[model samples]
Target: MAKRILVVEDNDLNRKLFCDVLKSQGYVVEPVGDGRVALESARSFVPDLIIMDIQLPNISGLDLIEAAKLDPALRPIPVLAVTAYAGKGDEERIRQAGAEGYLAKPVSIGPFMAAVKGLLAQVGAVAG
Candidate 1:
């Protein structure tokens, strides 16, 4: 089966773009708009990897990552944070929150896919 990827992004265009790219690369993409819904979907989808946006409405991505790390069901899933709020020391914060990797927006297709594949290889053991 294709590797499952949960895309948690708030922007419609970014969400669609990520999903399209991952789908075209043969991943099973589950897209969600907010952190709360992401949590719910993560349980049902049981995705191997997650691409999360930091700035979210209901719950922040950091909070979501922390929560996921505490939950045994979602703990093994690797989270890659894709955010536009990148600043000095931001990557450290993201990593501290439990995300394995960080990608800044506007994301480039090649590098983004590379990062995803690299992280997947480490955690999900599947290539992009």
Candidate 2:
């Protein structure tokens, strides 16, 4: 089966871009605009990977990643933070919050797709 990816981003253009790119790559993409909705949608879809914006409405992506890590069912799903916050220490903070990878915005397609493939490999590693 094609890997499933959940994309949580608030900006319309960003979400569309990410979703479109992943879809073109043959990933099943489910895009949500808010962190709260992301949580609910994640439970239902149980994606293999998540590409999330660190700043989100209702709840921050960091909070969402932390919450998912705490859940037994969701803990194995890898989350990659895609954000504008590429400031010093931001990558550390994202890792500390349990994100498997980080990508800063405006994301470069090549690196972004490479990161996605890497994170999907992680899921395969754990599952196998």
Candidate 3:
């Protein structure tokens, strides 16, 4: 089966762009615009990976990541933090929040896909 990816982004253009890029790479991509819906979708979608935007409406992506990590069922899903906040401490904060990897916006498709693939591979290896 194609790897399932959940894209949690508030911006319409960015969400569509990420979904399109992942879909082009043969991933089954599901896009959610708000952090609240994202948390619920994560449960139902049971995605193999998550590409989350840090700044979001209702709930922050970092908070969502922390919540996911706290949940046993969602904890194993790899989360890749994709955000425009590239300050010196931002990456560390993302890691602290339980993200498996970090990507700065505007993200290049090559690097984005590479990060996703690497995280998925790591998860697969761990699972096996």
Candidate 4:
């Protein structure tokens, strides 16, 4: 089966871009635009990885990452955080919140896919 990836991004264009790229690479992509429903979607989808956007409208992606890390069901899933407004310490903060990977936008396809594959590979190794 193809690896499942949940993409949580507010921007329509960015979300579509990520979804398209991942789907093209044969991943089963679930795109979520609302931060409020992200976790619920994740739980239902049971994705292998999550690609989160930091600057969400209502809730911060960092908080979502923290919540996922705390949840027993979601804890095992690897998260790759993507943000447009990256600050000096933002990456560190995202890492602290339990995201395994971080990328600043506008993200290139190569690096984006690399991070996704790397995180999935780690999961495979752990489960292998």
Q: Rate the local accuracy (lDDT) of all candidates.
A: 0.91, 0.92, 0.93, 0.97
Over the stretch 1-128, how does candidate 4's per-residue lDDT look in tens digits? 89999999999999999999999999999999999999999999999999999999999999999999999999999999999858899899899999999999989999999999999999999999
- TM-score per candidate, in order? 0.94, 0.96, 0.97, 0.98
| Ranked candidates (lDDT, high to low) | 4, 3, 2, 1
**Number of clashing pairs, model 1?**
0
Candidate 4: C-alpha RMSD after superposition: 0.6
- Candidate closer to the true structure by TM-score (higher is better), 1 or 3: 3
After superposing candidate 2 on the true structure, give the runs of residues whose Cα lies further than 4 Å from its correct spot: none
Residue 97's C-alpha lDDT in candidate 4?
95
Q: How well is each residue in 1-128 modelled by candidate 3, as lDDT tens digits?
A: 89899999999999999999899989999999978888789899989999999999778999999999999999999999999999999999999999999999999989998999999999889988
Tell me the lDDT of candidate 2: 0.92
Number of the top-ranking candidate, with TM-score as the measure: 4
Candidate number achieving the greatest lDDT relative to the actual structure = 4
Tell me which residue pairs clash in candidate 1: none
Pairs with backbone N, CA or C atoms under 3 Å apart (clashes), candidate 3:
none
Error of 4 at 114 (Å): 0.6
Question: What lDDT would candidate 3 get against the real structure?
Answer: 0.93
| Candidate 2 vs candidate 3, TM-score winner | 3
**Error of model 4, residue 115, in angstroms:** 0.4
lDDT for model 1 comes to 0.91
